[model samples]
Target chain A: MLWTVMPLEAVLDGSDSYEPEYFDVPWNDGGRLIVEKLNMDSARVVRLISGNANDYLDASIQPGTIIQYAPKNQASKQ
Target chain B: MTLSPRQRRSSSARRVRTTPHPALQEQPKTHTQEKEKGQDVLQNIQQLGQTNIPQQLSENGIHTITIIGQIEGHITLPPQNKTTKYEHIIPQLVAIEQNPKIQGLLVILNTVGGDVEAGLAIAEMIDTLTKPSVTLVLGGGHSIGVPIAVSSDYSFITETATMTIHPIRLTGLVIGVPQTYEYLDKMQDRVIKFVTSHSRITKEKFRQVMFCTNQLARDIGTVMVGKDAVDDGLIDEVGGLGQAIAKLQSLIKARESKGGSTDALDSDAP
Candidate 1:
């Protein structure tokens, strides 16, 4: 229910600029990803908000749905 | 009364310089200037009077911190029991790194060594911090002190400094389960990995030292004196404060040559 902005260069560098596991692939509400405790499944979004993740995301997609990408640098404030 | 002209001639011949060695003749005049500067600095240290560090030792922004007690994790004893916290020291270390006056850091240790986790944590933090650091072992750097010795860019141990490397030991009741034992083993692995990676000693050599059976009466470990520690590659040199400071200066100069600033070394105000 929250969103943060980040730069694309940060994720490419593989640095942990964001809090670990905070960002993830925002799947649609009807979709479900497998959750296994033993698999050590932890999402690591490198806080790439500007280009890569952001451009691929659609914030106004749907209320009950989640976008699977970060917000673009241009529409960040929106 | 006897005419000993031959003996006199021989003595005079010995004193006569036969065209000084070519190497000495080729020496640059600047070399002499450098030598004189070094001598002046030595005299300055002597003039500091007691600690004999000339009042100007801090001239070039070189500051020194002397840790005269054991630096380990929290324990019950008294004021000395104060465990150097990560939060407390992290800021100091960061400040030192960011300060423009501090050219380098000198950590003088006289600890009996405590808290493997805390000790390794500090050592690793120093190992990675982008600053020239030098550690001097004064009295004893035992147990987890092994990592601290190698954490700096270089290290010095006094002739009397003693370092003990022993297997990890815990003094308390523990959960007697397979999972608990597994967790403990993993934690130890983390420590050993950090130590071996940042130091010259290899995993096998470290294993031998950590498991030596005859060193401690109550535990299996190895005790290395100053020179031995250096020979074993635990400490870089067997020297005193001057050598340590000199090494720090050299490193600072190297860093400066690489376009980094050396002013942070002035003082971080604790």
Candidate 2:
């Protein structure tokens, strides 16, 4: 049951046909980031699955952040 | 007069030659790093359509969390709608509870409310927090937002702010069974129990307001403006942000003093 001021139709519009594609990437301090794939190279962060309280404080990894998918070799070089 | 294509190209080439190539100029390492940072910021802006992420205020002991738009639940809302995801908020609350430097919390609400279970979860967390907290309701705090507004140690509503009290309803597909109705009623009771326990409003008064007729157009509910909410014992006061902060600070001070006395007693116990 939903308790909201918004109309039911407006809230559930497009939900039936839309299926989000999310990937779980290992993040800093053993945390995992749930990101929705936008394209091949990048994904938008949806949530951070972490037990560490400090992990939630990082601004760069907050929800809505676009994370670039760098290959292991390229990431290590940087 | 516009220059011919040949003349424009020749002029641009000459200008480029006169102004040494940017990369050829000797630059400090910091300058290059700053440029890269700027590019990253630009890319983030382009991708997220937002200029900057919200930074926690470090200058004060009080942390403010604004609950606006829809309170999202298990299903993510479409991108166009503004939503306060419970996942983001729950972690922040955990961080706030663990952080010793933070003395109080101020929740600012301007929400239409959303998923019932998510809203109740947030409210329960706020109510159980050991630190001093105050909620200031601006604009409108409707539906599930009422429970959240009352969850804090003290709640304030702006003079123009309003709260809509209405019965919870099921959305989407429903089986034509009596059990479904019973389940929905039980879910609603959880919200009513939380709100009535935390605030001064009685369960009877709240239910009366919730089932009130003739107050809302085409809806069975009552809309309580700031002062009316206070008068009805639904909210503590009708004030703005400043008052809410002042109240929180005072509450924090009281807690500190009480803690100090308890410490003194512990020392004397030995």
Of the candidates shown, which would achieve the greatest lDDT relative to the real structure? 2
Candidate 1: C-alpha lDDT:
0.51
Name model 1 segments beyond 4 Å from true.
A1-78, B1-58, B72-87, B262-270
Give stretches of model 2 more than 4 Å off. A37-43, A66-78, B1-56, B260-270
- TM-score against truth, every candidate: 0.56, 0.78
Cα lDDT tens digits, model 2, B1-270, are 222322111000001122312222221122136565565567566544444333444666788887888898876675555677888788888887767667789999999989888999899899888888999999999999999999999999999999999999876688989999999889879988988998889999999999999898868989999999999998999999899999998998898788733233456675
Cα lDDT of model 1 by residue, B1-270, tens digit: 121222111000112232422222221122136564454344323321113221233476564544333342443122212123332344455555655655678877766565566677678777876878999998777766677778889999999889877666433467788987787667667767876776677788878887888777856778889998888777889999899988998998898787665433333335
Q: What is the TM-score of chain A in candidate 1?
A: 0.15
Q: What DockQ does predicted model 2 obtain?
A: 0.24
Range of the 10 consecutive residues with the lowest summed lDDT in candidate 1 chain B: B6-15
Estimate candidate 2's alpha-carbon lDDT, on a 0 to 1 scale: 0.75
What is each candidate's DockQ, to 2 decimals?
0.01, 0.24
